[model samples]
Target: IVDRIDDNKDGYLTTEELKNWIKRVQKRYIYENVAKVWKDYDLNKDDKIAWEEYKQATYGYYLEEFQDATDQHSFKKMLPRDERRFKTADLDGDLAATREEFTAFLHPEEFEHMKNIVVLETLEDIDKNEDGFVDQDEYIADMFANEEGGPEPDWVITEREQFADFRDINKDGKMDKEEIQQWILPQDYDHALAEARHLVYESDVDKDQKLTKEEVLDNWNMFVGSQATNYGEDLTRNHDE
Candidate 1:
């Protein structure tokens, strides 16, 4: 990814190169997420999601079973907000959201409410006991359920350790609202900004705000493992291929 963005082929990623790479990363993120949302919610196979279908999929069928007052309140509040969003996205007011509108509606950067909804849904799924928190067991079980049938992967074990170490900040062995927020959206986690800053910080050995091939090679592992680097694995694999 860094090499491709080094458009001048001068063995360095300048500010312009970093900016372009960030744009590509943002585009890829939006494209993949939009496709996933469409696939999951576009019921009736109409290539678009109508208001009713979206409501059914989001609000779920067992609304009455929401014994938790918080969950019930959240769901009720979400209904009108989602309705308004649907109407807003329905550019022609056709009571349906096309892929484009739905994509816009689901953009996490642009629509915070939608992002919250997504986060809440994720919490609900993982918080099986409905205790408004996710315990270590709950997290582990959810991960295993999503994976293919086999013994849990080593990565899952590592993730469990990470959750206990980083996510359970209070040492309570459970994740509450603040912890969950940290898990979902770590502080100052703007991927594009972080990536650009990290590339320059790691590779600009001369403090010139640009990378050279020698500098990048010197810190290759940083690019591969650092959260600040996007598409690093793909770039590595492409090089190998």
Candidate 2:
């Protein structure tokens, strides 16, 4: 992600480059959501949704069936967020959201609250014993659930190692809140900042606050490896054309 955004090829991402990279990532995030939102809410296949359509589609039978406290709380919170988003997206106050307006409403980097929800969902799926945490066994089992009979894949092994070395702080053989926080945001530890800071920190070798191609090459493993960096796969999968 950083390399592709380094437009001058100076091996470092300036503030402007980082901003551009963030914009691209945000756009991708919004793009992915566009189809999903439309599919679920555009009941008439009109490619546009009014507030009532969105409300009905989102809160209809499917969601109402899961009326647990968590689900209820999530639904409650969603309304306000969506309302704000709708107002932002409804550029002409047309009381309807077009695809373009809906896209405009989504701010990807500002979705840290959603990240917590995702983490909770993942914990729910992986915590087989319902113990409120995931042990190494549970983590590995969930990650490699699709594998048939072969030895674990290299990526899975690397993830296991990371689970122990990085995520298992205090060596309790399980993850805790602090560890998960570190896992999510390791650097300045601020989830709101652009993720490009992490890439810059890894490759900036000279203490001059900038990087060279050689510096990036030297840290290739850190940039490419799954366990080492959060943005690696995103960079690889969404590289600029």
Candidate 3:
């Protein structure tokens, strides 16, 4: 990873280079997922997946008679949701999805054009009253349970203040679609840059605001989770008998 991201070839990983590497990794995951799932749905192998093709591929099992009524009910609910998302992602309105459109459909949060859909979906999930807006109580309830009938935690109080002071930008008691979008997908936030900076901050023992290959390797666990090291699989398989 260090060798791939060290763009300057000065044996150091700068913040920008690391951020680019992380962004590349994210894109790679998206592309790989799309590739793995495309062949299953694109039965004709013409490089485009039609709406009928997708519906049959995904919901054929539900169409079978062996499924229970509860399963049928779930399929009925999910079918329209999937249709809406598929149509939104089909930019050409041809009712078919190319590789790019399929990517957008599968991971709408990764694309700027799909952000409104993301915001709308979030509101639909959180706005219990269906009033087309999210009030303070709804926002708090989404994050905290308080099932014990006890006083709110300090962090919950801080979040409520955050919602009033920052999230509800127009000082409205409730958050409209625009405010919900801003709250969830702030334009100023760069996830890759933030993660890169955090890794450097935690791993750069020399305090030079950059990282050497040795530093990254020394803090490998901090850079990546157990997936990279096989630590999780090993722990599960090698537990005391």
The candidate maximizing lDDT is 3
- Among the numbered candidates, top TM-score falls to 3
Error of 1 at 185 (Å): 15
Q: What is the lDDT of residue 208 in candidate 2?
A: 64
* Residue range with the least summed lDDT across 10 consecutive positions in model 2: 108-117
Which scores greater on lDDT, model 1 or model 3?
3
| Clash totals in order | 0, 0, 0
Candidate lDDT (C-alpha), each: 0.74, 0.65, 0.85
**Ranking of candidates on TM-score, top first:** 3, 1, 2
- Tens digit of per-residue lDDT, candidate 3, span 39-89: 999999899999999999999877786468888998897788889999999
Candidate 1: where are CA atoms >4 Å away?
A: 64-70, 111-198, 225-228, 231-241
**lDDT string, candidate 1, 32-98, tens digits:** 6788778678889999898888888888864767788888987997788678667765677888888
TM-score of 1: 0.57
TM-score, candidate 2, is 0.48
Residue 232: error of model 1 in Å? Answer: 5.0
| Candidate 1 overall lDDT versus native | 0.74
Question: TM-score, each model?
Answer: 0.57, 0.48, 0.88
